[model samples]
Target: MNRNVILTCAVTGAGDTTGKNPNVPVTPRQIADSCIEAARAGASVAHIHVRDPETGGISHSTDHFREVMERVREADTDIVMNITAGGGGDWTPDSEDPTRGGPGTDIQTPAERHEPVGELLPELCTLDCGSLNFSDMVYINTAEWLREHARLVQQAGVKPELECFDLGHVWFARQLQQEGLIDGDPLYQLCLGIPWGAEADTETMLAMRNKLPDNADWAAFGIGRHQMPMVAQAMLLGGHARVGLEDNLMLKKGVMATNGQLVEKAGGIIENLGGRVMTPAETRERLKLRDPSTGKIVGGEA
Candidate 1:
């Protein structure tokens, strides 16, 4: 069991979850507030995504991103920001013309995905290693696209959190490491319980965990009901944990949960299992994230 665990709270996801869960932050102000609340409750990192304020739909607008970043920075909190570079990959085939994209399809080139990260220069950003079926829609991140995205992330001097939804994704992430695309010790987030991807179970998590690089700093999160259980499982297996409204919406079966409540609960679980949640500074040190102002990796064992 790992004594020190870094808990990242994914504040609001790029999902159609706001209507499902009233607490899912829609506007930039709400997202920034939720991020701060999670940080105060023991989250070491805040994984962020923006949405259209009027529609609450996922948006790739840099203006929205800037607003959230400004609010978070103005607050002067200790949370390490990790923005999503995983946007603009949704592709649903049009029934009328199968070759063309469908109504829900929103695909962007690799450079588009890297725009927010490159412009804002967050401490960390995600690099989705492969494409997979996201429910009925296909989230496309081909090898070529990934290579371009990885290179841009490396250029921006931001660490990429290799997000693996399945075993194949994990394999490709290792390949990226072999090719010397990622810098510093590799960081990963094993995304389980998403439909048509990896299942949320001990056997699955363990199998995927075994495939990661020896020096990787990895965390795992299960969507919906599997969220809290996977948190415990991840900690027991010597991996880190993630929580918040992005992966789950409730403290229990019928209860509506906020991001702060979820972080507090996850922290309680960590302490119960004889582990402690690492602070934001500690996680920054472990990931070797560049300081937001200095453009230099913070102090650590390295």
Candidate 2:
């Protein structure tokens, strides 16, 4: 069992979850406040994804990202900022003309997807390692696209959290490592319980965990009801944990939860399992994360 775990709270995802849960932050102020609250509640890292305030839909606006980052930094908190570079991958074919992109299709080039991370220079950013059938929509991130994205991320001096949705994603992530695309020891987030990707079970988690590089700093999260259970399971299997409104909305069966509440609950679970949640400083040291200001990999507490 891992005695120390890094707990990351994905404050506001690029999902249509705002209407589902009242606490899902939409505005930049709200998202930044949630991140601060999660940090205070024992989340070492805050994974952020901005949304259009007016529509409550996922947005790729750099201004929205900037405002959120500004607010979080102004709060004087120490949570490691992990911005999402996984946007603009949704593809839903048009009903009228199946040949072209439909109403739900939003695809961007590698440079476009890397724009926010490149400009903002956060400590860490996510790189969805492969594509998958997300529900009825197809999330596209082809091999050539991933290679280009990986190069862009490497140039920016930000650590890319290789988000593996399935076993093949893990395999491709390893290939990226082999090709010298990823830098440092490599950080992996084994995203589980997302429909048609990887299941939220011990066998599946273990299988993915076994496939990771030995030097990798990895974490896992399960969506919906599988969230908390995966927190415990990840800790037991010697990996870090992740939780927030992004992956789950309920504190329990019928109770809607805020991001801070979810982080507190995950921290409690980790502590209860004879493990302690690592602070942002500890996580930075462990992951060899780049400093937000200097863009240099740091060793000790900042």
Candidate 3:
């Protein structure tokens, strides 16, 4: 184990979980409040994905992101803000046309998907490595599109957390690193146990972790019931962990949970494994993020 493990809390995802858990925050204020609560519970980073307020579905509107960022920034919280740049990639095939997009399709250009990151300029944002059959639909992130997104994120001076769902995606991330598209020590987030992605198990996590660049800063997460188990696994394997209402809503079987409860549980797991939980400031330094105002790391440090 690395001894110092970072815990990230994903407050609310853009998934269709509104009916499953009533506590998932929809509005910006509610989302910011949940992020604050998670930070209080020992999460050094907050992985955020905004949603459509009225419809309670996923949204990629820059305004929605702006609202959430404004609220979180104005608060006194010290959690590192990690906004999602992985949205606007869903593609549902047309039932009638078959070759074209259907009613639920939301495919977009790389620039469109990254507009919020360019505008908000957060310390960190995600870059999904490749497209996959995400459940019944495809998450369309072609290599060209990914390269474009990576270039834009690097140009904007925001760190990209390469989100790898499977082994092949990890390979692609490495390709990007080799091409010099992704600078500095890369950051990766291993996403496990989605419908068509990698399974949530020690073997799968280890395989992906082994493929990462030696100098990379990485974290792993598992969905639903596998969430907490992955937390312990990541820490024991010398990696960071992520958890929150976005990934798992149940604290126990048949019991719903809040974001704070999830963060607290993950923190407990890290502490029990003889790992020190990182604060937001520590994570920022480790990831090499410059303070927005000074154009240097906060505190003249890092």
TM-score, per-candidate, Cα-based? 0.98, 0.97, 0.97
Q: Judge candidate 1 at residue 42 and give its lDDT.
A: 89
Superposed Cα RMSD, model 2: 1.5
Give the C-alpha lDDT of model 3. 0.90
Q: State which candidate, 1 or 3, has the greater lDDT.
A: 1
Cα deviation of 57, candidate 1, in Å: 0.4
Report lDDT (Cα) of residue 229, candidate 2. 96
Q: Write the per-residue lDDT of candidate 2 for residues 135-198, one digit (tens) a residue.
A: 8899999999999999999998888999999999999999999999997799999999988999
Which candidate wins on lDDT? 2
The CA lDDT of each predicted structure is 0.92, 0.93, 0.90
Candidate 2: where are CA atoms >4 Å away? 293-295, 300-302
- Candidate 2 matches the true fold with a TM-score of 0.97
> How far in Å is the alpha carbon of 283 misplaced in model 3?
0.6
Give candidate 1's total backbone clashes.
0
lDDT of 3 by residue, 1-302 (tens): 87798889999998888899998999888899998999888899988999888988888989988998888888887788899999989999899998999977887798998999999999899999988888899999989999999999989888899999999999999999999999789999999999899999999999999999999999999999999999999988889999998899899999899999999998988888888889988887788886655667553453
Worst 10 residues of 1 by lDDT: 293-302
Model 3: per-residue Cα lDDT at residue 225: 98
lDDT of 2: 0.93
